[model samples]
Target: MKVCFVGSSGGHLMHLYMLKRFWADKERFWVTFDKEDARSLLGEEKMYSCYFPSNRNIKNLIKNTFVAAKVLKNEKPDVIISSGAAVAVPFFYIGKLLGAKLIYIEVFDRIDKSTLTGKLVYPITDKFIVQWEEQKTVYPKAINLGSIF
Candidate 1:
């Protein structure tokens, strides 16, 4: 199965990167911004770029959306697993429209509630996971996958 890991920098990428071992034998790829931390975490052979800026700017958002749409068209992954900040929004939407499963893993920091993306994509997501049990009250459908750490 082809899998695409989509997320932003720091904690989001770190959590998603941990899943790499499970897909070591399958087709796998990742999408992240041009941040140094994100670039360092990406493997030389299995990564793609999306021009998402850390700050919220209209230009960057539009550029990232276009880049995301193109990547989804080209990769045509079977599923997309995401630990979102913001970039996951476009990736998930496009992947979903293309008939791909969208799996969302809420950020580890979200102890009491779901992240914005988690809430936005909840109904459409094939699977929703939460690391914190406390988040269950907020996202009743979220599966408790424990911590990805």
Candidate 2:
């Protein structure tokens, strides 16, 4: 199955990387920020860089939406997974619209409260995974996969 992994840099990307073993043998690519850390960690893996300043930038969000739509159309991945900040929003919606299974992993840092991105995409995600049990209260349908760390 072809998988598209999407997430921001830093903790979000790190947590998502922990799942590398699961997708190691599968056909996969990534959608993330273009940063030194992401570059070093991803190595030679296939990746597409999204626009920066995504969290609250309406202009870039709109730009990234189109980018996400195009990528979804071209890649046609069977599944799209993300541990997000804000960049994943467009992909989540577009991926689901394109019939790709959507999986959203709640970031590890937010145990007591739901993340903005999590709340926004929760309804559309096919699978919502949480690292901590407390997060289950926020995302009742979420599967507790323990910490991705």
Candidate 3:
């Protein structure tokens, strides 16, 4: 199976990296911003870099959509999994267009409420995994997969 992982730089990347255990037997690549954390975490793997836009900016979002479209066309993954903070938006959308299964894993930091990315992308996911059960009420379709830590 071919899997593509996407996320932003810090905690999102950390949460996604923990999923390495699940993809150990499959082929995988990554899409993330060029940051110290991403460089360190995904250095040994095939990674595609993109500009991580600020959550409040609209212009950057347009650019991200274009970048994501390119990545989706190029990688052609069977499935795309994300532990997100905004960057997951375009990737998952493009993954859907390519007929890939989309998996959204809510970050571990969100203990009480659902995050902006989690709420936005939840409906589009084939499987939604949350670390906190408290979030299940907000996103009832999500599965409690326990904490990534």
Best by lDDT: 2
Q: Order the candidates by TM-score, highest first.
A: 2, 3, 1
Q: Which residue pairs clash within candidate 3?
A: none
For 37-126, candidate 2 gives per-residue lDDT tens digits of: 999999999999999878988998999999999999999999999999899999999998899999999988899889999999999999
How does each model score on TM-score? 0.91, 0.97, 0.94
How does each model score on lDDT? 0.83, 0.93, 0.85
TM-score winner between candidates 2 and 3 = 2
For residues 1-149, write the lDDT of model 3, one tens digit per residue.
89988888888888777777888788998888898888987778888887756475678777888988988898799999988878788888888988999999887777788888889899899999988889898899999989889
Q: What is the C-alpha RMSD of each candidate to the true structure, in Å?
A: 1.6, 0.8, 1.2
Candidate 2's TM-score: 0.97
Q: Which candidate number has the best TM-score?
A: 2
Counting clashing residue pairs in each candidate, in order, gives 0, 0, 0
Candidate 1 lDDT tens digits, 69-108: 8998999899999988778888888889999998999888
In candidate 1, which residue pairs get closer than 3 Å at backbone N, Cα or C atoms, i.e. clash? none
